[model samples]
Target: MSQYGKLMLDRYPEKMILPESSVIMASDGTVLRRIPLPETGYRIKAGLGEMPQLLIDTFIAVEDRRFYSHKGLDYQGIARALVNNTVRMGVSEGGSSITQQLARGLYLNRGQNLLRKLNEASIALTLEKQLSKDEILQLYLNQIYMGQGQYGVKSAAERYFGITDMKHLEIGQIATLAAIPKGPSIYNPVDNLELSAGRRDLVLRIMQQHKLITTEQMRAAMKGPYIPPVKDKTEIVGASYMDAAIKEAMRQTGLSRKELCAGGYTLVTGMNIEAQRAMERAFSQEEAFPPDGKNQRAEAAMVIMDQRNGEVAALLGGRNPSTGGLNRAVTPSRQPGSALKPIIDYGPALESGKYTPDSLLPDIKTTYGSYSPANLNGVYRGQVSMRVALQQSINAPAVWLLKQVGVSYARGFAVRLGMELAAEDNHLAIALGGLHSGVSPLMMAQAYTVFANGGILNKAYLVRSIRNSQNQVVYSHVAAPQQAISVRTAADMTAMLRQAVSEGTGRRARMDVTVAGKTGTTQLDLPGVPGKANRDLWFVGYTPRWTAAVWMGFDHSDPDNYMTAGSGFAAAMFSKVLSML
Candidate 1:
């Protein structure tokens, strides 16, 4: 490697190349998401060609009038600055060329020490020989930090003027941003407008004198109607989805975190903006969940999937989709509550061919070692059909049925449905939604699709494809469908779930269109909490068009005031999202 290459890596390690955001777009080409770059700096990558002539000229005129004429250092400018500083007894101006400035920003510390200054100069000279003037300028434009957590010309333009293309910027706006690098704290147009305007006029004056802008253009720009941007807070879109997609992409592509961020990849996802917006509106409602306060807060998550293709239509990880926090839809394995019964116990029971929907099952309570269970309403009929037993979600009957069919069979079935069941998961309590680890909303939703899609099981996926800067496809999705169960079994299970929704605990999820689903509410014993309350609530359901699962609960451990009602929380939210479709 050359000296400049070594210097670039030694100072600004390849890892410090600065992260560029990957865009997430919907299937129909609608741009759905961009994760908010951290407060460290927000830089949307762009080439030198993206810079406008006016903005580029303004920068050169104000910062270095002899920029194009200089090789890497301007001896005359340095002499003048030295003379001026000696007379003033202070450093008022910098003599570094644009290439020198880029070197400092990229590979040197922000200090005025002589040793650092000499190093900066050495590196700048080396860089000029190694790269073109335009390349150095592009790096400078991207690495320079503007005020308010923005880096790069493209991001700054978008933040300050709502303009993605720099060429679209007005003359006054161009001058305003050009003046910011002098002292962003003082000349930031967003916070201190009056000071910024004065600096902008000074830059315009220089442009006029340098003949970079016409005298008439300078006068109009100085008169100034610079409309600053209105977005004070960065509005991130589909952050949760993007967050998961990046992780998945990294695993599949075997790219490091820095490489993935710096690759400038474009991710196309199965997100439907309409469905996502509807889910967002549902959570944003005035009464979606209990109010949050202090260290304690109620949280909920939902995942809507296209059953036929296993494409994730919409996913809300938590209340704040922009946070990119723990994605409950894909992580945070919580007990599926009664939602597990249909797939784990009942669905497999019918698929085994030994049991039919009309077959009689014992609903009477019986002891299973030290564990005994009761129905939700505390009333159990002596004998009931399998359909009625499932509809009522009778706990005793489910437990007995698991024993009759053998616990291994039900647990194995859940594993085949894409759930990673363990030895601890193979117990009679598994029939009553008891498990080793909880299920994610994504897994639960996909499992239920076996019935909705007529036994075809498609792997739930968010990203459909990824492309690089050359518009060449780097990654594409291949459809993999498995026949998880018999068509006869899927049809029978679908009928039973529909009956449950129409007449049982899932009645709260009634929709105008035909729907099949199960509501699950699990009450676990708390150490010191009172009232024998349930902690987790879940609603896993599917329509012919979409399969969805909803989970509502407190993020913290169950306290004395744990809320555990699935019908009102999960079921209602499910209805809100599904009804819109």
Candidate 2:
């Protein structure tokens, strides 16, 4: 029994999760996104419908030559495998017939022993009787484990070529797939090109030996560049960001890992690839903001939203997605400092019908109960309009506006705008971005969508559609934009934002297009530094075409590393990326 178990274990093929059902393409079939499968084990039934004759023939020729004659185990092949593996010392050693391979794959463990081998034969024989020949072949195709956490031919195809249909396989492609079952690592095309080519030629030679292909076809298959499509190259840019997104996706989709992997769910996401690449380009420029030696690091996070779609176009959770994996974008709930003023004070003021783009407010030094808010200059500007107050990010004027708008009413308005304002009833200090738990840039982007889309808010999505291994539609995503504000009111606020960008505190953000945005800075409220500028800076803005938010701060508080609010380093990074975009 022990010896049999050992043999079964030695021959058992590794099992892995079935391929996930996901189709990442635009509504027009232009692929834009792809979700990978989870790591698990599953029976192969994904690609039985469209598998080509050549694929089946190749599997038979390489896996089990006497498949028709054998009951369940090919004794001759087993004898040959035992002799070759024991005597011939090359890495391409051992041969298990298709039935024996299937036996080990399905019923036995991966240990080498006679008892397990005998058990595998028994199960193989049983499987042959219980399942049809075609069904057995299908099961074998799906059950066999390919290296790299892949199982089944369908998954292997998609994992490697980013496609599903088996009929698509060329002769060279068939040879490559054929080569994997024999010592997957030795013939791993990604790792060793020469070994992979040699194995492929060997498979082609085997095909010719079995008369499965013409001599000319065999010759052509061996000549060169058996290059299959690139597969399994997951571009993990901010491993932290991807992890965060996956967690959120899983939570929102409500799909189990198996369902996510095999159900072919198309997750429509709000991520914008162009904006993401732009952010990557900005941060990856080492010469712009090099670290202070090794200890002092430079990192950044930015979020771009489409005002019309309310979809998150791009999000950079960290300065370097590869090494620095912390997702600063979606995870961090950093205080917006003066950035919160617009949501609490300005947005509410606009909604109340008591304020206009030209509404006047005071930026003078003033105390509201226990709290006193000051401007970045720490001085007083006697009288300023609401537009000037917002542009300068004056603390006192925002507080006064918050008070005039009624704290409770303002808080309610902020919620309507999507700011998740922590204040139960808006405190005057809420205008200064004072809250217990702050908001993420993602949420902030969602809030700003009100001003961009003439008041309609669309849910964000990253995936477009999902299809099963058989190319059957499993899930589809359709965007539904909701009305959050009136077009007139949103346009009125946009006019003020335009001034904030063109002639006010956000003048540094001046660009070619009609750019409108806000700047925010927070004082480091630490001992002996009540008014010291924090390392944090922000410039969240939008144009008719795009809306984006950029934030910059030190990993640690270094006063010298700090920028002057919207005019700081973060603003520069935002500008650099926006220019490229």
The candidate that wins on TM-score is 1
lDDT of 2 by residue, 1-581 (tens): 23453443445433323344453333334334344445443323464667878878888988787887777677787677777866765323335667667767666577766666567666666666656777778777877776665677776766555556778877877787778887666675765678878888888988888888999999987885845566535343334334444555556567665566455554444455556667787777875453442345655678877677665667777766642356778754666777666677888888888887678787678887788777767787777788777776777778888888898888877777766565343467677876666666777667777888888877554444444555565555567877776787788778888888787767767777788777776666655543655655677788787777776666565544543333355556666777777
True-vs-predicted CA distance for residue 291, candidate 1, Å: 9.5
lDDT of 1 at 213: 85
RMSD of each: 3.4, 4.9
Task: State candidate 2's TM-score.
Answer: 0.83
lDDT of 1 by residue, 503-532 (tens): 987887879988899988877577775544
Pairs of residues at least 3 apart in sequence or in different chains that clash in candidate 1:
none
Candidate 2, lDDT over the whole model: 0.67
Question: What Cα-based lDDT does every candidate model obtain?
Answer: 0.80, 0.67
